[model samples]
Target: NWRSRIVFLLKTNSSKPMLHLIGNRPSADAVNQWAESLDKLLNGTTVFSIFLKSEFCKENIEFWTACEDFKMLTSRKARASKASNIYEEFIKSEAPQEINLDLHIRNDIIENLQEPATTSFLAAQVKIYSLMENNSYPRFIHSNLYKKLCAAARQEVKYNKS
Candidate 1:
């Protein structure tokens, strides 16, 4: 039933790219062609900076340290609290960080990959930032860029441990 549902969804969801391979049918070439087309369209374009705010780690301090590049604003609970000082303090402390072009490639890989993939994609953010800094570009981020960054970040976080 789930496989049928996935097939039906893929058939109907033309807006989203098809998974290419399903069951025994091979889809590598089709997927590769589509990916090449997408690559041409997005070349030289950067999505910009992303502000990360996730509920995944909750209050775990280790998670906080790992994501030091992100401005760890308030906890999710603080946002929902009766008094939001904790959230306010968190925001006040966060230094700005931005997304770099690495996000675009990681997303492309995840979208085209057949098997479940890991979250090592997030490491791209660090690598890209380093590249930008080496090239002498100032670090700047924007809110809208988070969509791709979050997708790649979530994917990396999802597959990293395994």
Candidate 2:
């Protein structure tokens, strides 16, 4: 029934579909392919971001991405400054976008921040990654936003073929 409803909507929806493009018109297979891995999902497009934001867990991905960027710094000073900013923003207690982390891990990160290295946030980043991979990602795979994206992708494929 729900599947039929989606089909009907896809059929009757205006020529201007509410499509969120990730590069060229993505295939339905591309959307489905992301379900295989968290990295794929994150690297795929803004669809995951849109879904996560809708679920009020956008900070999870934000923190994860920040950690990734933090890992790329070659300069000690830049790494230290970036690490402090990351801690204040996401790891510190009462931070603006404080992520859910174990007290021990949080304390460990605080200690590491004294001489922050590119790997300083590795553990906390892993924890956040697990949280998203296990929790929000599953929900995202089933969300209306994900479904709409797949449907729109299919529609676009059809439109392009004609």
Candidate 3:
């Protein structure tokens, strides 16, 4: 029932305005930036995130984003705390949002948790990033969502000029 509800929401909202989906009219350049790299794509908009949710793989990006935020922490205490949270959420077996990772990488992360540095999740993050870049990114670029976004962006450009 909950899964059906989520599907209904996604379907119902799919036809809503671009602003509702992405918060602003994403420029053609912004859409192009997404194609260039995963970092640019994640930093640029939430539409890709929506797409990932539709594909039922949003956790990959979520974990990646969390890792990025985790890297920016300067305080060791903060880093340690975040490291535990991240591991619990995305690294530990049966985690709520467990990511697909190699056993060795996962084991390494578990060991690192004893100290919990900023880079504790770096290796796992990179693995997930590679999976998204090589797999999800290409599909997203070709999806109807991306096509509609591009069309919306082009329309915005035209409207701006006229």
Candidate 4:
């Protein structure tokens, strides 16, 4: 039922089937179906959707203004949130084995807080943390602060043992 509904919606304007592609347009199935015929056409449709949306948004100031409003919408919010998880995966892979990710993120926020241009982005982060903590703090201790505290704790441990 769902597949048929999707097929119907996609075919409403054109009789051609829309290939929902991610990565590459001419997938194995499309290539197998026509080999060379549908390749260019399918790729063109995907490219058109992307470039057309960008141009349309730029042409209409109302559409540009709606970027934030659209983000509040379920579809846009889901897409936006996916980017952060992708970034987190990259961070985990690139960071040193012993580095604490939570502390790393916090430290990055603190570093950004020092810059006036980035104040708004940092403010959003602080508000989220504040919500999690369930109380207000005089200042947000970012990842760098956490690292320094951990280092100090280690030094204390070493001194006590000696």
Clashes of each: 3, 0, 0, 3
For all the candidates, what are their Cα RMSDs to the real structure? 19.7, 6.3, 4.4, 25.9
Best by lDDT: 3
Candidate 1 minimal-lDDT segment of 10 residues: 48-57
Please give, for residues 85-152, the per-residue lDDT of candidate 4 as tens digits: 32332223452211123655545533533232313123333333333233211111222222233344
For model 2, how does the per-residue alpha-carbon lDDT over 98-152 read when each residue is reduced to its tens digit?
Answer: 9999999899899988789877898899999999999998998876666677777
lDDT of 2 at 23: 40
| Ranked candidates (lDDT, high to low) | 3, 2, 4, 1
What is the per-residue lDDT of model 1 for residues 8-61, given as tens digits with 9 covering 90 to 100? 432352443232322432123322232233232123222211111221212222
User: Which of 2 and 4 is the better model by TM-score?
Assistant: 2
**Alpha-carbon runs more than 4 Å astray in model 3:** 1-23
Candidate 3, 34-150: lDDT as tens digits: 778877888846777777889999999899989989999998889889999998899889999999999999999989887887788888888998999999999988876666667
Q: Which of candidates 3 and 4 is the stronger one according to lDDT?
A: 3
Which of 2 and 3 is ahead in TM-score? Answer: 3
List of clashing residue pairs for candidate 2: none
TM-score, prediction 2: 0.81
After superposition, which runs of candidate 4 have C-alpha atoms over 4 Å from their true positions? 1-142
